[model samples]
Target: MTSPRRTFAIISHPDAGKTTLTEKLLVAGGAIHLAGEVKARGANRRARSDWMKIEQQRGISVTSSVMTFERAFDDLGVITFNLLDTPGHEDFSEDTYRTLTAVDSAVMVIDAARGIEAQTRKLFEVCRLRSVPIITFVNKVDREGRPVFELLDEIADMLALDVAPMSWPIGMGGEFEGVLDLETGGVSRPEGDSRNFQGKVDTDVTLPERFAEEVELAQAGYAEFDAEAYRNGDLTPVYFGSALKDFGVAELIDALARHAPAPRPQPAEPAPIAPEADEVTGFVFKVQANMDPNHRDRIAFMRLCSGTFKRGMKLTPTGHGKPIAVHSPILFFAQNREVADEAFPGDIIGIPNHGTLRVGDTLSERADIRFTGLPNFAPEILRRVALKDPTKTKQLRKALDDMAEEGVTQVFYPEIGSNWIVGVVGQLQLEVLISRLEAEYKVAAGLEPAPFDTARWVTGDAGDLKAFADLNRGAMAKDRDGNPVFLAKSAWEIGYVADRYPKVRFNATRER
Candidate 1:
């Protein structure tokens, strides 16, 4: 029998050493010989899992990147690891949700110095809502003066997580040295340092007096977690480490293998749909187009929701003159592409040599049940761009279409001949697009900050005035102008703004 697979997503606030953690995990699992670093300029600079050009330049992940790792578990024997690395920014939260929906659990990384911030809380809530088990890691303990205990308390309070430390920090802040594994009672520190350890605990150590006390306290806390505690509904476990120094990484890997839940049994394939259903039958989650002298090609990343896709599969895709044959089954790995001979239920595989798949469009392998809805995209932040040369307008349109297909961007054409309006998740996202355009297509796009609406609810005359001004680009909206406009239609947007601008009290009657 085949070994079971475990799927989990890694999430965190921006710059919290998430990619660093991922690299360590991949290395520990023997997926790569030596770990790669995120350099400002280099051949392999960005997150190894983060393969997008836009993502590398921005230094922020805009989409979830999936990769598999395998390692032996002390208790579970051999395990297949299916890990998804998610975006840290708020605008890409929708992408994060989709990634989570496909996985069984998550590892939430937090900065030791910064503790839990707004995005951390938001993502945690989403996990809670999905009832996904989560493990929390407090990273960057190598930095001096980091308050490990205090950060642990903050994580539990801010995120309301039932967290217990799996290891104790040997020292914190500037004097930080290593970690004491609570389970094995082993001590692992920087390799070169001459720190003698008799067993799991150190003897005659020079650790901070307060830290020594905290170690004992941390062990006690772990002891307190009984089967009943887990059964009664606790969702998070806290671990400490410095990904930069690689200290405690082994223990973290061990904890993941031990505590993280395995993916549930794969469900039986869905029944075949009829030969004709107009409800938008298949989903195009990814797209890549290549044009060379010999061949003009487009690869559509698809997930067959309710049908089977085999060799010679056929479907009448929208905007196509006739049903195109499934020319070849393909798989996308960042810039590299390959062909998969067959694909089936719940598998995300790519297809090449076809013209019909659009981001968010559904496809049908059989003709019966259809998947109509596109995964939700957050409200776009509007910006103005002028082509460096008028002649490059057509080239720019094709480039933008590819970007949209990749799901990292949104392009809007307000009018037929208007200067193109590109909706982006954040400023960094725009910078990345421009950089890619100039370098790859020899086109430099000039961007000008444009006024955009992030609606806030207000009711009292003062509140109404403020709300109206925000809608008209007058007051608070102007103050926070560059931010992406909050979708006025979403209750989440309404409640978020209402709490943010409490002074602009809502008149229940008017709101209704």
Candidate 2:
């Protein structure tokens, strides 16, 4: 029998302590030794998940990271946990969306002080769209935050999610004594200055007399925890704690193993693929380049949907109906990885590939099964790449192509110029592009202001599109995939051009 798998993502707005929580969860699972603060210098301070230099410098997760670890639960036996840490910045929403498609559920991290934020709401909507159940973790309870009722009401009102507080804080900020587990009635408090987990949860259903009425009232106000409702994405079982303090993370993991659904059937063409399906089926939700800067390797993050995937198996990618051997299937704990001899449903395995595998490419024993819903959003920002050395133009082209395939940026070749244009959704992406260009590719390139501010896919009759393209040849360009796109100078220009060419459709997003 397959080991039980719980695949989920951690999402939040910027500075919600999602990264800290991720580290603590890893420590609890025995994946790592310690959960150190970001301020601590040297190797000891570095987070395993935040491996990129740019990430370390900027203190942000610009790309989604895939991490896997395992732990034993008394009720569920030993279970495999796959955690995808998504970027909190709204700019990386595209990457987050793709990562969500590959998970069974998500852990929505909201700051107790700020409550539901803009990026958090956006990510929640993405989760809701796919019916992805969420386990809410209200972090920073050790610090001063909004009242419990206010936060819970905001969750109920803003997200429309039924709030089920699994655990409640005894008090907040300096007065914060500990958290009382509602289900187990176990209480654990901070022991010393370290704030590490006490590891001793008194399973007595006793509550402090002072806070008894408050707990009672809050429990009465919110709906009871219904496993069915949560699995259906109608409700969220909330846990409150300070991830920085290593509080409530263990309970959060327990909640995941106990309540979170196992590898569910994945949406695919023809029919949804069940976990027990005979054929080995999976889809590439992300392709990252230069994960190992030394070897310049490219890895495709594939989420197994069905069957037992063994090493040295040849799976055909839907992108190119050709069989590719996956020799080095990797099970990841952030950047630390090991060769996965075999993987089951809901397991995310890293398949090192060349340019053949891409985001949204489905790999299976056969070519017929193609998983869907990975999207490619049109770039919100475009810039012309000016290489420091013109002699290295070919190398820059190769690097840009590699990055494009990885979804880090989109490279567009215009019908007009030799200088290729790179596009991204936000300003940070431009910084990442330049950083990677120097660090990984050994080709230093600078991004100059592009004439076009926005780009859109042009779709319509061949004659009509050609007529439009012919009229505005300067704005015409082809994506790496050879798809025609019209680069508009600005939003107003897009509107003006659309008015003139009514038959042509300008798509902001394209199906991968």
Candidate 3:
């Protein structure tokens, strides 16, 4: 029998209740006893997924977290869920993008009052590009918000997705009663707090007499669910509830178990690999440094695409081409992890990194196939990093190299032999890097504005690339991986280079 698996990521704009929704899902899944708030006061518990110190202090997820657990539905039996909670802040969008590549589907959380925001729109576009199926959660329904139809229309207009309501809110704001399940036409009301409501009647056979109007609205919304459109990725199944109250979480989980797609074959260079392929195949989508402070270790997050992964399994990392033992394969519940003896397709496992692994690298028992679709975009912001104490230069260099390998920031070596240039997608990434350098690496670092405003990786014949580099020595540089890069002072300079070096193709992102 096939393994029941559902691998998906949670995405949204900042403060759209993504983290809260994640906690509620975990609670409903029986992964944890109590759901923790993102910004709990005093000694109160914080979110499990936001385990990084920077995240806890700021109450924002700066990195993507992988969580694995199981939940059982009435009809679906036990289903394994690999949940990837991604950063909602725009500064960490690159991290989110990489995380998206590893998941089979995505759950997009939108604030009921705010509808779709900028970050949500950007992430939705990425999902559309990959044709990843999306399930919508209209959160914070206990608070006053726009009409459900307006929110649906906005999603359709802005994100170009057909909205299919799977569950409807009974009432809004202070009068918030519960949610109506469209499939069963049953009413699910919160018994009290979510913790107390656990295992209580999620679906009632008879509707309460006081919710007569809500029943009619739910019936109307229930009639709008189009299975055909939903299956095509053209439509999204929408669920409404207060994640804080955990009213509609169980229904959402049920829908996911019944409807979400299972592990699917992903495209590789030579061919697509089936999830049931005998060979063990996976791709490293993220590398995190200092998840454990004591060891100062790094972790490579690999999403197993095929076959079974045993602890200490011997596999070839495509980048190195040498056989290496997969040591202490781990499964994560936020920062907390346990030794994983075996893992299957659609499950993400963390491998200890000692400088050998890099993001986008693939590993397999066979050496022929290389996974594709993971690409690095050109940095929009450029800065020159300087070490405050020259004595700690070695430590600083090692830390910077580790961060670059993790794809947190791009380090560049200028041909002029000046200070190392730091390239980042946004200013906030640079800030996080500096903050980490001081807090984690104990290195005092400063950033100075660099002359370049844009960068591109040049691809063409070796001779042509050489000629371009020689002609533009001032603008020429090499990234951390020794890839050739051309920095431009402005758009005009990029245009001028394109006109001058017509033989070489300049790409905004490096082709994987």
Q: Which lDDT values do the candidates have, in the order given?
A: 0.58, 0.84, 0.81
The C-alpha stretches of model 3 lying farther than 4 A from their native spots are 38-44, 172-228
lDDT-wise, the better of 1 and 3 is 3
Estimated TM-score for each candidate: 0.67, 0.92, 0.91
Model 2: how far residue 453 lies from native, Å: 2.0
Give the count of colliding residue pairs in each prediction: 16, 0, 0
Q: lDDT order of candidates, best first?
A: 2, 3, 1
- Write model 2 residue lDDT over 1-512, tens digit each, in one string: 54499999999998999999999998899988777673466866866788888998888898889999999878778999999999888877888888999998999898887888877888888888878999999898877678788788888886698988787776521233344333344443444322222122234434455465667677788888999999998899888888887778888998898889999998899999999988999999999988888887889999999999999999999957779999999998877889999999999999987788888899999998888888778899999999999888888988898888777788999999887999998788888889988888789889899999989999999999889998988989999889999998899988988998899999898888
Per-residue accuracy of model 3 over 144-193 as CA lDDT, tens digit each: 77776667777877767766666656543124323433344444444442
Best model per TM-score: 2
Report the number of the highest-lDDT candidate: 2
Off by over 4 Å in 2: 1-3, 38-41, 172-210
TM-score of 1: 0.67
Q: For model 2, what is the error of residue 427's alpha carbon versus the real structure, in angstroms, after optimal superposition? A: 1.1
